[model samples]
Target: MNPSFAQASPQALVAGDPDQGAVLDAALAPLRAEFGTVDLVVERMDRLGNWAFVIGDMRSPGGGRLDMSGTRFADAAEQGAMSSVYVALLRREGDAAGDASDAATESTAAGAGPAAPAEAAARDQAGLQQEDADPAVAAETPRGRWVVVDFAIGPGDVAWLGWPQEHAAPRALFGF
Candidate 1:
């Protein structure tokens, strides 16, 4: 749902091709470097709407169950606003920026805090595998956890690309 305006009706968000000329890569670059283990997806807010997009991250590799939903952006302005928010978040989360993309992606709780014993061990092991990368980058790429860092969109074509948010509802973002 968009935070800036009430949803006029029940509209579903669909996945979009970030590679298909969407102007989000730059805003998302920092997040891409920080959360390297997940695939970040941008989706149209609905099959008919064209004024908004939503951002979500898939912790799964290639594909998996347990659909994840991300935040909503009412327009390109909102997308830019969220990008700044994410950059700050990435920094607060001990941002990393090297070789994290090589790590395996997996689903994790949206509100996960410190790792449990089992999760900690797994993160430690994954960290070890990334010994060749910067210690900070490897150390911060928690195994099975991710967050939305940024988002954007292109001209709406009404095709449900099945971006991450398509599988479920989304969170209101930026209050506009």
Candidate 2:
């Protein structure tokens, strides 16, 4: 079985708090508008190493809730693989560049909110080149392990994969 095909938890539509809702709505608006209903599922590790903010469809291709523990992204190989997958998916969706920028912008904006320093830092960290500044890049995925796949049905079957790695860490380098 393709390990990458493992399922992930379903993401709930944001609720409560108009402000938070608006932010989420705005953040996701472009995606919804552009993609016409995406099957996005996000799972992040919390301080306790437990999954948090799981979202989207959870059913796997084989039929079962995706086992998050088994979907490993801690290794560089996994991260690189996921990165390539994400880039491909983005290219297919025609919204890769915009997505990357929005992600970085959102992070920086949340951290500093309209400050030059923050914006500049975000730009640098995002690894965006002059060619990437075009809005069209949003339609193309970054040249990495990012993959995109069409699952054919079930709560936005499209997915963008990413694995966070810091400085090519040893755990990921030697396949620990």
Candidate 3:
């Protein structure tokens, strides 16, 4: 753990934080599923919302960066279409950059998360569900876990997490 990161409060760190890559990894895994071998990781963000300032590394075989600041991810999230919109935009980038080999590796399997952040927000079921097998997870999961809050990725958006974030997104990450 970096000393700089440990300087922050534990509660603050537990939230869906993009700066702390490992903690944020769970939230970003779905995006990775779309990337395949391309290392499209979100390195920094002034904020994580509709009008967010995002800076990320895009080593899409060709190697580059995702210099999107005022993109459409926010708008799509408002309509509960963020998932599809984001994936479509990424797919377009993959095709244009000739990253077909990596793109084809993505799977159309189950547990692919919601079609849009809006949908998850509409039915935000985090604290509401109690029958989950893991009592510890069920109790702790709802306190801070969130990625697609309020129909979009706001300050609580993870975009960095891996397994935990993905599973929690459809449930805990929903709504503001």
Question: Which predicted model would earn the best TM-score?
Answer: 3
lDDT of 2 at 20: 26
Model 1 — which ten-residue stretch has the worst lDDT?
Answer: 84-93
Candidate 1 lDDT, 81-175, residue by residue in tens? 22222211111122234333333221222333333334433443343221111122212232221222223222233222332122121223222
lDDT of 1 at 35: 44
Candidates' lDDT values, in order?
0.29, 0.26, 0.28
Give the distance in Å from residue 111's predicted Cα in candidate 2 to where it truly belongs: 24
C-alpha lDDT of candidate 2 relative to the true structure: 0.26
Question: How close is every model to the real structure, measured as TM-score?
Answer: 0.22, 0.21, 0.24
RMSD of each: 17.7, 15.7, 16.0
Q: What is the lDDT of residue 62 in candidate 1?
A: 63
Candidate 2's C-alpha runs over 4 A off are 1-14, 42-115, 118-176
Best by lDDT: 1
Q: Runs in model 1 with CA error above 4 Å?
A: 1-22, 45-54, 64-175
Name the lDDT value of residue 131 in candidate 3: 14
lDDT of 3 by residue, 13-51 (tens): 323553333323433444444444445444433321111
